[model samples]
Target: MGREELVRRVSEFAKESEETILNQVRKMGSSLDWSRYAYTLDEKRASAVSHAFVNMYEAGLIYRGHRIVNWDPKGQTTISDDEVVYEEENGKFYYFQYGPFVIGTARPETKFGDKYVVINPNDTRYKEYEHGQQIELEWINGPITATVIMDEASDPEIGSGVMTITPWHSVVDFELAEKHDLDKEQIIDKYGKLLPIAQEFEGMKITEAREKIVEKLNKKGLLVKVDEKYTHNVSKSERTGATVEPQIMEQWFVAVDKPFKIPHSEIKGVKSGDEVTLKQLMRTAVESRDIEMSQNGFRKTYFHWIDNLHDWCISRQIWFGHRIPVWYKGEDIYCGNDAPDGEGWEQDPDVLDTWFSSALWTFSTLGWPEKTKDMETFHPNAFMSPAYEILPLWVSRMILMSSFHLGQVPFKKVLIHGLVRDKSGRKFSKSLGNGIDPLDLVSEYGADAVRMGLLVGTAIGNDINFDESKVKGYKHFANKLWNITRFILENHHEGVPKTLPDKAIGYLDELKHIVAEITTEMEKYHLYLASEKLYHYIWHRVADQILEETKEVFASDEEDAKIAMSHTLNIILTTSLKLLHPFMPFVTETIWQELPQKDEDMLMIAKWPHTKD
Candidate 1:
């Protein structure tokens, strides 16, 4: 697709989604402005990315090198690890006979250019066969002796202790070739075509060449077997859904190893003594107990990841991102915020990775690089609530980036929520056809019930098995809240004001205690526990106990007693409404408007009920 069409579609889709979500938030009684907060990544974030890249490059961490990347042929660019997803595909595991050995492979099309074979020494089948042992392998062109070597990568548990080393194709083979002095014989071209080494089959596509190669092998009595029903995982481009070819390319990388501080330890790097590095900041934050992880178990995983973190690749061969600012003039490099001044110097065509842009989200969204008021006010953000999958890729990078740029961690706390699953326990996904649209639920049970249903039984770092019954139950709760409020308003025939009677005021201590409990739970990120507490107070305490007592007082028919009881009901209802407003804002606002609320009062913006001295 053209850039105009692609960008227009993406923008329109995002605009619609923003409208949907902002409408829901408004219906739930939130005060956030969608227009003020929304930002398109590439457009608004380019300057911030430029600043970060310039800083990183000057720090001596960024360098250009030839590396293997996840290449999308359709997109014709390099995609991030998060963008590529694996899909199970049905294909043949074609095995070709090389000498007395049967070499198993998923892509037999590349077999004509295969250099040599490797076998692990631990395999019992290959244990009898010593290293350097030659076998007479019948070739289509001629017969040749193929030697065997002990390769740790060749595991007998999965295969026959042998690996068909295709240096140009596999990432593992590429890495192995780099570490050793093994000569890399390039066979497959960049377009997945066999090189001149394929003899008459030169320049043939990998897919079509596979069939011809297999037929040729069968005629030469060298074909082994093919598992037609073999299922395997393959990476595909997220944007275009095209299969990715791991092609070798020169890219820029951030040296994340030595200078970066290792988590779960006190050893600072050599350059970290005087400098305010991300590692130093993170180490200090962890040591001082400044960072709060909602699920403590995830901290261990975070520590393990940071401890073993390798160099991060930050460049991509794509157009839809922030282009690198470096320029080259006869191999003399230039790094700056803008393109170079010379006529002969050409800018690098590759763009910065998406993660590099997202790393600046917290501050970049709030205006950075110019030291604006928004940046100062919201530089060190309070909370980050992303999914657990991007903890390493996004969350960790955000922390590192913020610490490096701003000299502080971006967020003080992280609330890692669970994924929502369907009733059968399958994750709600577009491909699975099991996704439950929130808009449909809002239309069916109302937005309040939908919000309550989501927040009711969820725990930190646990997936929620969504059921319609929970939503139905919350709908009943909404009904109960409406009915109870209407009951209180209905009983007050004397037009009771917002002011409370002395007897009603006596319940302030108990109400304060309840408010304190809820506030504490919310502060600790125990959302489910807070929801449960609200349910118990509203259902059991007010509806069952207090309402029953008020009915008894009304039966006695003392004018003063009646006033006290009515005022107490209103007091409890008002407090309860305020407490539940964050979760069930729509229902609470509807009921609050009917009561003796102040002029121009809004339930969502009203102060949270707090404990009194």
Candidate 2:
């Protein structure tokens, strides 16, 4: 979607000021000053992509070729494997008679473009249909000759030996078409509509085609059987929910050589537990700090994906995204940031994949290409945390791309997490009626309440079940913090002491210890652990133990006792607020503003608390 249209639709969908992430700055209580360093991908698309293309071209990493890609017909683009979501849905199997043969298919809607069929040659059912034999069949579309290509190592079979092919749709057919030099004519449009070649079925959507084809089959008595409850897995476009087509198309690719050899290639000593996860192996150490992180237990899965990585199809058959920079002049391809110097040079109409631009995000977002101050300051990112699904699609690519350009990985460590599923463990989707809008949560329970609930027991590489009770509980925590601040202000209206009294010394040590613990856990990408620690310390230690003891001490009315209580509360609460800032920024900041010992106007920018006195 274009930036204007994206912003407009997001605005219309939300009922509140901060419904969508477009309102993230407002929802996160971020400052407008941060906007000066940011620009949208589309805003700098032409120039940034040009620089990247030049870099790849000079490195000999860019090439035009044919590759079998996961093609999203509805979105009319090529999405990476990361975007292909496999879901099991209740569908039907249609068994029918097609001319002189019987066949079964889950998608008869795409049957109009059927080219030819293959059968397992070993099967004795169709003994008459021999290998390399020619057969003629009269079809509803036209008269076409069929050549029998038999005994596929894993051929599509109809009954014992019969098979059929849908050339422009299935991956097997695409491979067969390539092997046998058969032609492919797209019988389906970008919107899943049938082309004119289907005649009466032309221009019908998949659902429309399914209804019409079933009716036609029933009328002809060719509908032998219908399995109404045929449960199967379908690869749908994650962007549009439309079924994906496995068509072979020419696309530009960035060839990142696989880190490991092909599967089952060779093994000398590498075994289970020897190397923990891919992330650990790639764990970067910067100066004195090190980041070793991976999602839950998905390290094995991550290594599996990286070991068998393929060249990324970086081109998309779309209009809006960054257009590929290569220009074609009569089969002589010339690729650069700019268009060719002469006329009749047709620039590639296809745009680069959105991730192709994103793969450069770590550097590009920091004002790369010109060695600007931002680039130098943020050369290697401190951390990269994205959803686990994109580890191969985005993270791996960013590593390779940045390593090539800047001689380093983009980030020191990568933190991965799973999706937010519902109470039943099903992913929250519109079809499941369990999608939660962050705007609704923010409006209902306040922003920090929702955030604390999400972070508090969440582990690296884990999916947390969405529950309103958790948010409600955290909302209660926020209320408790507010009341604690109000109570402290009411009792001790005096300034904070320069030094702590003997009674306050123990409390100060614990606060400093908590700060050290939180920093250690956060360094390992254990932000949730840090939040959990803060929750326990605030509710149990500070509120229940220290505050109660302080009240009793203050009841004595000694001037020394009053000053000690004030000093202890000021430093302890102020330190605790700093520790909780990352997980619950807004709540901690608000509470910090009323405290007397604050070093910065905003807790968000205050110096991090440490264990040292």
lDDT of each: 0.74, 0.72
C-alpha lDDT of candidate 1 relative to the true structure: 0.74
In the range 421-510, model 1's lDDT, one tens digit per residue, is 898889777888888777788888988888888888798788888998999899999999977987788777455545655646656667
Task: Note the clash tally of each candidate.
Answer: 1, 4
For model 2, how does the per-residue alpha-carbon lDDT over 1-613 read when each residue is reduced to its tens digit? 7855855675455446434555754684545565655433445645776888887766566777876778887788888778888889998998876556777889887776665667676776667777677667644455567667674643444352465677777766777777877667777776668888878998888777886787776786777788899999999888898888776678888775523222211112323224222232233222113333444355556566666656678888766567788888897988787777978999888878877777788888776676789877876777777887787777776765665556555776677887788877888877878888776788888888888878888876788888889998999999989877876777674754566677689888778788888899987768888889989999998888888888876778676668767877877878888887777788888888777666898897899887874
In the predicted model 1, the residue pairs found to clash are: 99-137
When summed lDDT is taken over every stretch of 10 residues in candidate 2, the lowest stretch is 260-269
* Backbone clashes counted, model 2: 4
Q: Residue 45: error of model 2 in Å?
A: 4.6
